[model samples]
Target: MKDLTILCGVEACAIFQNSFPEQPTIWPSVGEANRIIEKFRSLPEFERVKRMINQETFTEQRLKKMEAMLKTQQKDNRHKEFTQVIIQRLDGSSAILPLKTDDDCVELDNVINQFIKDIDRKMEILQNEGSSSNPAPQVS
Candidate 1:
């Protein structure tokens, strides 16, 4: 039995065991097992059978079980619609603003416009200060 178990490592042997569980054979030696495995692998149906075993099982009962599991999970979970406004800056920074109502969108627009105006005003002040300090070398 232990010797037969070792032969299961071969692909053909494993497929044979799965396909015909009732009739199990014990090869006299590993070389004999290898020769038989080679013959089985040479058959056209070997790859097909291997693929069938590896593929997902989609039997009717299995699908019904999966559907029930999904329904149960859905019942336990709370689903909500989320709305967000993403602001991306030139310096590779980002801000996400979540909105719950129409009024929040209107308020967000006003806030963003005011923020741009503030930045422009600060830039103008900086430019004015830079020009005054330099004075363009008197430009006579």
Candidate 2:
């Protein structure tokens, strides 16, 4: 019993049966108990139990603490305001457009629209060339 307490936490004997019903909860030696604990730690149920403990620990007080921390971070970021638009091309090249004003955003939108139009025109040209090369069969 004392060895079980040393290997596991306190009250090892009391909660052992309920905690691990399938496996033998009471081990004769501390080393054996430690091996069993290690074996159980590898199990998925161990991870699920850890997650449940974590979820249980996240009380309202912890949430308030997190909210306060977030508010402080937001206050810190209020002074520095900038927007970045990332455009990733098919050629594995990327462009980052930094926008500080409404006019800059509008310009970016126009550029994107123009680029789309250019791509559409190129696709149309390719489609027309393909159709011309392979004409439809005549129904004689």
TM-score of each: 0.32, 0.34
Model 1, 87-134: lDDT tens per residue?
343335564455667755765666567668988999999999998988
List runs of model 2 lying over 4 Å from the truth: 1-95
Q: With candidate 2 superimposed using the best TM-score fit, by how many Å does residue 99's alpha carbon deviate from the native?
A: 0.8
Compute the lDDT for candidate 2: 0.62
Clashes of 1: 0
Model 1 spans > 4 angstroms off: 1-95
Candidate 2 TM-score to native:
0.34
lDDT of 2 by residue, 1-140 (tens): 67777877743322255654485456555676677667656769867476344554778669899999998886444322211233343345564445677866765666667668988999999999999999999999
